[model samples]
Target: MTVCAIEMTTTAPFTIAADGSYAARLAGDGEALYAERWTLAGPEPYAVPLPLAQPEEADTELLPLADGRVLIHRRVAERHAFALLYPTGAAAGPRTGELPLGAVCAEEGGDVRVRLLPPSPDGRDAFALAVTGAGTTVWRVAGGAFGPEQVARIPGRCSGGVWLDRVGRLLALDHELDGTTKAVAVDLGRGGEVSPLLQITEASDDRLLLADPDSGLLLIRSDAPGEPRLGWGVLGSSLPVRFPECLRLGDAHPFAVQPGQALMPETSGVALRLPDGRIGLWRPADRQVFRFGAPAGWLGGTGLWSAQGRLHLPYATPEVPCGIVGMSLPPAPPPPVRLDPAPPTPTRPIPLQQAPL
Candidate 1:
């Protein structure tokens, strides 16, 4: 389905959990910003306002945890801080206020920038990337034993964070160094040991956008085909990445992939944002893009797919402050059977510029 966009610059994008149970966003009122959490696992999705005593800055980032606490990231001068906000009383009772957690600072400014990664698949721990001129530091911003802790320091300026596994131990990042960019996997469990993940070609800039832990399906964008194109690949497969001609729409990006479809990666639904401010839905097996109009006030490029194939989009209008509209996937047609002899083996993807460190 084609996703539409609205000019809602004041509000921040919703940070949803991997399981689609909860989400957090920064809602603005005139010049002030406040944190809000949405509970989606219940009968009906609803939001809880989480305004602190003072208004939050526009750059503050928020991520919701499965336990119902919202992790907040803010910059105080040069130090980027981390904290958790939760209601003091029980969820059913009146919300006393937000309880701030300890902060993790990464002197951010000038040539350095720090931001939270996507919600961890485990939904218990949270992480952030501190990108500096020399390297990127991955910090456990929340859910650590003692507040925030430095987990790994990866050499090179990295961007784009995707958890390759369910436990969040293996992280895939697009590392740009010496004028080339390629996706590399960081083994957080092993002192952030880095390894090649996506190396389409020596010159190609390969980036991993989204991955499905259940199916090992990876949504990738790379310029290996002379031009940047969206493609799909298996996590550990040796097959050369297949750049589908149907996914060549300029500037389009995939944001969400269907989960719980273990071993059926090709059937999982993929959501992408078209260049002209529309959302595109496609499946690898079908190899065709489905167009649909985006809801008014829909958060562009941010959504969650249910295990049952429902795509839930979070949107907010002036009348309805927080809302989610789900789009049901159209039944896919059967694939054509092959009558000719089996094809030759596909090409193996090229290795990274350097060996794993």
Candidate 2:
């Protein structure tokens, strides 16, 4: 029997870059769906519509890059087409530009599924995962010297794409094999070298939820404690993973980690969804979880954390078709020093390894 993957379905109106610089989304004008890009790193955020002569399909996925280009993935029958969307001159002038990258056609069985991965940490490249019964293929859809290149293929079904390092080389994916799922690190630079990243237990299902490259912090979910619970760990730290009681809240899921805290991982803010649909904020230094009301027309469970502890949530309403609500968090106190280090548990993650392509 087949099992469902632990990946979160992309339903947000906008998909933001890992650097919080730009966003891409499909906007609807009552009848047709069109792609729109949002600029967030400026003094004031603004949206640019990249509508073509033809409307974009409802199922098309968009991922924004650091260079202001939006990568679009559209499925035409069994063939998956990729392209780059950029704004042209005036609307009265030439139409918005779309550079067709290439396409990936699925096998005949209709069992293959393809989707764009999250924005890469480097912000210059975009990737997609095509899952088939044989294996999962990673495709470099955008920001490639040659358009749409097949970079790596990993055995077994893999889900969840979390970049472990800042340069976008090490990727952590939850690999499902032999009815067991564990989070493994895929060295994209080494042609998808697989290594064990999260081995909480032999039988428990472990999935990586979120990662912060700046701080080397990782948010994880695992059933090692008899049931699935959210936990925290450092990328290469010798410390065993810790599942805080405050993180076990019902229906809560971590979405973003505050960046630019390389020396203080515990001080980094974590943005999560509360059980009541509101936004919840927490930090490892502070064991308490604070709840904030989500903005009206908020894209559910989607947001980004700034280095200074501000949460930027994207929302669209009649009044504000494209808007981002910024929430400033109170400063967190420094972490308390523990003279006696915690004992290492058996659930520590294994070090990453690389293999030839």
State each model's CA lDDT, in order.
0.78, 0.79
Cα lDDT tens digits for candidate 2, 116-204: 98889889999999999889999888878988788889899999988777777777889999999999988888887788898877887
Per-candidate total of colliding backbone pairs: 6, 0
**Inter-residue clash pairs, candidate 1:** 1-292, 2-279, 2-291, 2-292, 3-279, 4-294
- For model 1, residues 68-161, the per-residue Cα lDDT tens digits are 8898888886677777787665656546355555665445435558899999989999998888776889989787788778899988899999
- lDDT leader: 2
TM-score of each: 0.88, 0.89
- What is residue 314's positional error in candidate 2, in angstroms? 1.7
- Off by more than 4 A, model 2: 1-12, 91-93, 108-110, 338-357
